[model samples]
Every structure is written in structure tokens, then in C-alpha cells.
Target: MTRARALDLARILFVLLTLGCAWLGFRGRGDEIADALADTSALGLAAALLVTLLGLALTAILWRRILARLGSPVPERAASAIFFVGQLGKYVPGSVWSFAAQAQLGRRHDVPARRSVTASGLFLLVHTATGAVVGTAAVVTGVLDAGGPRWLWALGLVAGAVVLALPVVRRDVGPAMVLMAGVWLAYGVGVLALLGPARAGLDDLPAIIAAFALSHVAGVLLVIAPAGLGAREGVLIALLEPVVGLDAAIATALLARVVHAAADFAIAGLAALRARRTGVRPSPGLRPADRRTDL
Candidate 1:
């Protein structure tokens, strides 16, 4: 079989495996999620989704900055559509899918494949590094204090990626890491907001944030799980249960997965519409080729 076909098969099998694991886990303890949902606060969920959206928007801005730095900048609308729509690929198995999608989508907006791919690579690198650093700090402060040394390997990986991509994104390292930290912070806040600060308590905030960041890194590094589906939830629950108890931890994990997925599609949908209806208008001196820019 061709490499493409093999990859497709692997994705399908891994997806099935993830689904099977989820089904079994939920089957035994489905009542926890249901009970949690019964007690769930609408205001909290709404607040969570709002913060999650804000984080996602920040991510798009980061991508746009990366693109511009690479000399293949698209308009804001074009950037949104390209970035969000490309992000849909993360739902598929494989960490590289989103990057590949971004690179392809960019070509429609006069962004060359090479620059777009490079920018996406750098974006992931910067994002991973920030998540690692933040996660490590959080862990040191409260969560898994003993495991902090082992987790330094994650920091090492980040350092290696930054070294490799530094030449291209040297100017963006500081800002990109800061922006990525903001994204994680927003998501951490969203998780707390969803669970209700009363449940997690202000004292638990740092641990919650640490759990959020580390669980995400675990999910991404696993790679076999689509969008970190089963892996993220498992790691999240594991990290949170100690602080929040089993029921609240499970609820937070499940709700976060659903809310974050909804947020992703929402951003993708709106950006797709915006790009389709109103991207950058062509100027009078434009060539016919430039006028044909597809959303």
C-alpha cells in the first residue's frame, strides 16, 4: 500500500481504539458525567465557552503573526479562515495534520506553501515550549512536586525544537511564547469557570492550570489520539482528581472536551463564512490571478 493509504488506515484504527476505550470507560461510569451535567451551571458553561473562544482567537492571531514574519502575510479574514479551517484537521489522527492543512489552505491566499509550512512548524514549537514551561511551573508550585524533575524532559524537548526553529522565528520567540501562555491561561480559566470556582477553590487554581497545561502536552505527545480525545481526558482526570475529587474531575474533563470541541468548530465555521463572504478586496492594479483568491 502507498504511504497515504497506510496513514489513513492507521488513523482509522487508532480512532476506533480511542472510541472503544471511551465507550468502555463511560459505560461503567456514565452516571458521573450525567450527574455532573445535571448539577452543571449554565452560566458557568457559557463563561467557559467565552473564555475558550478568546483563547482560540489569540491562537489565530499568533498564527497570523507567524505568517507575516515569514513574508507571506494574508489579510485578517483570510488568516482566520485559513488557520481555523486548517485547525479542523487536528480532529484527525496525527499531530502533523493541522500543519499540513494550514500550509495547503494558505496557498489560496497567495501564501506560498514553503513559508506557511514553516510558520505552522514554528507556531507549534513556540506553543509547545510555552505550555511546557507553564506546566512545569505549576507542577513545582503544587501539583506533583516530586515529579517535577522527570518532567524537565518536556522542557528539554521544547528547548530542542526552539533551537531548530530559532533561525526562522528568533524575533517571535518572546512574543509567541507569551501569546501561547495567554492561550493556556484562558483555557485554564475556562476550565475553572466551567467547573465553578467554588468547586475548585482559589487555592486550587494553580494546580488546575498546571493540570490543564500538562494534560494538553500529554495529549499532543501521544499523537495516536485524535485531537487528544481519550488521552487528554484521561490525563486531565488523573491530574485533577487529587485536587477536585473523582466526580468533579471527571465532569471537568468531559465538559472541557465537549466545550473545547464546540469552540473549535464555531471558530472554524464563522471564519469560513467571513472568508467566503468578505476577505480582502482586490485593489485596482491587481492581476487576474490575484483576484481569484479562494476562501
Candidate 2:
């Protein structure tokens, strides 16, 4: 088979594997989720969803900053749309199509593919790093209690730290990592807001944040399923189950995904509409957004 075809097949298999994991995980908690859903007030769900939306918006802002740093300067609306659309590819497996999607969108406005990809990579790296630090602290302090092996969190932190340090290694680090940390902090605040009274205290907040963030990054890195659906729940539960009950944390994670999905599609649809109205086409590859002018 051609390389492209083989790659596609691999992605399909991974996606299937992820879905299977999610199914089994949920199956184990099927009755629990149902019970929680039945008891969970629509108001609470709404609050959680709102918090998630806020996080996504913050993500858009973060992406906007990264693009700006690269000289692309995507409009907030466009950045938001590009972000959400790329999210759709999370289910696609193997390929980091989300990054490709964002870079392609930037090209319409003259962004260079390399610069765009670099910015995106840097943002992701920092975000994951921040999550790692936060998640580990949480586990150490006993915030989340999901029952996975302890070594996983250690491995995640080490990997994240390595990635975060890559810019220094290249001797030409950019603003991408800083921008990622800022956005991630904002998102963590949003998540805490969703928990309200159940949230971790000021003293424990740092650890809680780290645990939650690391769990999230691990889920994405695992790349087993679309959007880290099951992986997210498992990791979060492992980390947060102590502070929050397993059922509650799992529910929150699921609810967060739902909100993210809704926001993603909503923004993507608008982007598609705008693109059609403006007669713009997606670029052929990922690149930086400001290639028209020399930086």
C-alpha cells in the first residue's frame, strides 16, 4: 500500500482502539454515569458546560496570540473557527490534522506553513508541560485518585518537561511557550469555577491544577480515541477521584467534552460559512500566517 493509504489505515485502527477503550470504560461505569446523569441537575450541567466553553474561548485566544507572535495575526473569529474545526480531526488519529487545519486557514491570509506549524507545536508543548506540573502536584498532594499506575503520571511529567525544554535546546525559543502557559492557567481557572464549592482550596489549588492539566495532556497524547474521550475520563478520574468522587469527576470530564464539541462545531460552521461568503479556500498545507511580509 502507498504510504498515504497505510497512514490512513493506521489512523483508522487507532481511532477504533480508542473507541473500544472508551466503550469499555463507560461500560464499567454505565450504571454510574446513568445514576449521576439522573441526579445531576440541568443547572449543574449547564454550569459545567459554560465553564468548558470559556476554556475553549481561552484556547482560541491562546491560538490567536501564538499566530500573532508568528506574524500571522488570525482574527479572533477565524482563530476560533480554525481551532474548533481542527478539533473535528481529533477523531481522525495519527495525523495532527488539527495543527494542519489551523495552519492551512492561516495561509489564506498569507501565513507561512512552517511558522504556523512551529507556533502550534510550541503552544501545544507548553500547554502540555503546564498540565504535567499541575497534574503531578495534584496526585502528590492527593487531589485526584484515578486508579491507573502511578508511573504513568511520572512518565507524563518527564515527557512534558522534555518538550517544554526543547526551545532552549534549539537556542531560539519563541513566545509560544509563554503564551501556552498563560492560556492554560486561564483554562484551569475556568475548570475550578465550574466546580465552585467543590473546588480545591487556595493552598491546594496549585497541585489540583497540575494534576488536572497533566491528566488532560496525557489523554491527548495517548491518541487512542477521537478527542481523547475515554483517556480524558480515565486520567482525570485517576488524578481527581480523591478530591472529587470518581463519578463526579468523570461526569465533569464528559460534560466538558460535550461543551467543547458543541463549541467546536459551532465555530467551524461559521468559518465554513464565512469562507464561502468570502470565496476563500483552505491552503494546501500548514504554515505560518504572515508569509506575505518579511519578518
lDDT of 2 by residue, 160-262 (tens): 6676566432332345445445555655554454445554445544544665576578677886566676677676666556766666666656555544555
Model 1, range 87-150, lDDT digits (tens) per residue? 7777766677777777767766677777777778767766665676677666655554325365
Q: Compared to the true structure, candidate 2 yields what TM-score?
A: 0.66
Best by lDDT: 1
TM-score of each model, in listed order: 0.79, 0.66
Please name the candidate that would achieve the greatest TM-score relative to the true structure. 1
Candidate 2 segments whose C-alpha is farther than 4 A from its true place: 1-35, 140-162, 168-208, 270-295
Over 4 Å off in model 1, which ranges?
Answer: 1-33, 143-165, 279-295
